[model samples]
Target: MKRKKWMSTLLLVLGFVLYFSVNEPESAYAMHIMEGFLPMGWAIFWWVAFIPFFVLGLRALRKITKETPELKIMLGLAGAFTFVLSALKIPSVTGSSSHPTGTGLGAVMFGPLPMSVLGSIVLLFQAVLLAHGGLTTLGANAFSMALAGPVVGYYVYRWMMNASGKQKLAIFTAAALADLSTYVVTSLQLALAFPAEQGGIAASFLKFGGIFAITQIPLAISEGLLTVLIWNWLQSYSTNELALLQRQMKGVKES
Candidate 1:
């Protein structure tokens, strides 16, 4: 089973590289929806929408820190991991760039709300320091990549963990789908903002989704594989930390 999984992962990587080589765009925008890309109303709307999640995430993070200080390093590492992964952009045919969210593992480990905080921080850093994302679109970008992705990814991880019994498979699927979900949500946001003249929002969604999927699908798969590898490495080197995380997850599930 492990061999098969590795082989499949190799194939996926090869396919991603092949596709990237063949269809690499001449110029493309960086990831996270860019800055000032959305209208004032839409921007404010997303900011308002994200505020509740951000507050909840902040509370959850504080609780975690107060309750289990030992896990702080692990959580910091997870946040850094997400920041690095998201900062690396792959240009898409849609004239924009997409990248891995790195939210699935964090969501599954620390719960979705905490991941929301971590993801928001990453987005903020990218917007301000790297200039990858934008100040205006921070809310929209955070809503899609941080809140939506983690929520979906956490639930998917729960479902897969319950159904599969294969931890690797569950982790990979959850992480991959989480990454894809961000793009899906972004597509919807863009579609709603700039509906197609002929077919409206639905058509525009399809158009944006189709364009993003070309690069995003491969990125999702790669992130999934990377997540599994990271998990394996943690299991080997940080067994105690992993156990503590599992206990936290169990506590969350029970409560």
Candidate 2:
């Protein structure tokens, strides 16, 4: 089972790389190439982008597996849920729609490692079926949305939960922060991909950051509230579900 898991991950990574290489563009960044806009540089970028997250994910996995079997199953289910939900898109303006992405919720539930793997799966499916993001951009997109978002959200949520006395308040605050952090990190990724000609990284960041922030702010808030509501409701009515969550969290801690 362990070897099979590793092999499956390897195959997915290789397949992801191959798909991007065949479809990427020369000068354009992969993130900018929505759908059907393939570039070679973008392909190279995707390959380069995988290194850090892959390392982090491996380390995380090593740490995560030291827990109870039931916890592991819960984490797996959370990842699967995130993968499926994120693939469902809602209409937005600017000829592009938006989706929940689910990184924040996944991070809250299972931490970052599993979320990275889950995020990669979600992006892969989005590229292959929905044609939302791109094959070449999958790695970069996953890094930004899955890796960065979850890491940020996890830490932020942990901090809030630890600092606060009230559970509801902590959950609400964490949810909002996580959602906003996801969008901010995603914006940073875009800014890096589409740097301005005149000023440099800072200037490009400001420009792209402003536009992306305006576009994503409302969506982020809505997602945050929705996540909190759903999570709280689940925790309330579903004793088994809450027990499962606690088990997974214990596993994560032990690992």
Candidate 3:
């Protein structure tokens, strides 16, 4: 009952954010804050911002491992999945491209702890190797994409699954919601970091979220459908692997 309530609240919050984000403006920061949007001092300030959250996530992971061995493997796999998936960019606009973040699927299957850790790793690599994000903005990026995305995704997925008997429908709904929610959270972060004089927080979010929605909504839906298909396929063709994965997670938690 408590979990259900929490999920409901999360969905409501996500929905509200999405509604606002749909009207936000367009900027490179719409997808991610660039290398120099914030000055070095400010960027460094935000970069280290995720330290506390990372520590909390690590502690959560240790607690989770007490009950499951599979958690460690899942974390590793999630990191790998994010790394590989993000490395493959698909053309969005003429010169621009985007990739599936995969934080949603990770959170749904392995909980938010692992997903945060995994996402951080992937983002770090992307920043260093591909210059996809930014070194100074690492903290902001990690918090928005890694921590917030997965946590929201996990709760949303759980909520939808519990509400529906149809597994496929639940998975699809969760995936779409999670993807959309991640973008909304990103917009909120941008709004906070780069406040507008006239519009304030609400105005900033509206500007960034609106433009981001154009690119993100379709991508999110595609990601959601792919995730559902993959999950359903795994359930049917590779229950043994899924069982093993779950068992390993349980062992990681226990250990």
Summed backbone clashes in each candidate are 0, 7, 31
Model 1 alpha-carbon drift over 4 Å, by segment: 1-27
Q: Which residue pairs show collisions in model 1?
A: none
Please write out the lDDT profile of model 3 over residues 1-255, one tens digit for every residue: 656655654565455335434433233222556566766765676657777778777886776567655456555656775675545444444334445576777777776776677778888888888667777777777777787777777777667666765766766666676667767877787787778899899999997777556667776776676666556545655577578666754565577
Ranking by lDDT: 1, 3, 2
**Which of the numbered candidates is closest to the native, going by highest TM-score?**
1
In model 3, state the lDDT of residue 192.
77
Cα lDDT, model 2, residue 145: 70
TM-scores, all candidates, are 0.89, 0.71, 0.73
Q: What is the C-alpha RMSD of each candidate to the true structure, in Å?
A: 4.3, 10.9, 9.8
lDDT of 1 by residue, 1-255 (tens): 756766665666556445544554455577578888888889999999998999999999998899889999999988987887787777776677777788988987898899888999999998899887798898999999889998988898889888877889888988999899998999899999999999999999999889778888888988888888777767766789889889988998899
TM-score of 2: 0.71
Alpha-carbon runs more than 4 Å astray in model 3: 1-30, 39-49, 60-73, 88-98, 244-255
Deviation of model 1 at 244, angstroms: 0.9
lDDT of each: 0.84, 0.61, 0.66
How well does candidate 2 score on lDDT at residue 181? 66
Cα lDDT of model 2 by residue, 121-143, tens digit: 77777678766578776666776
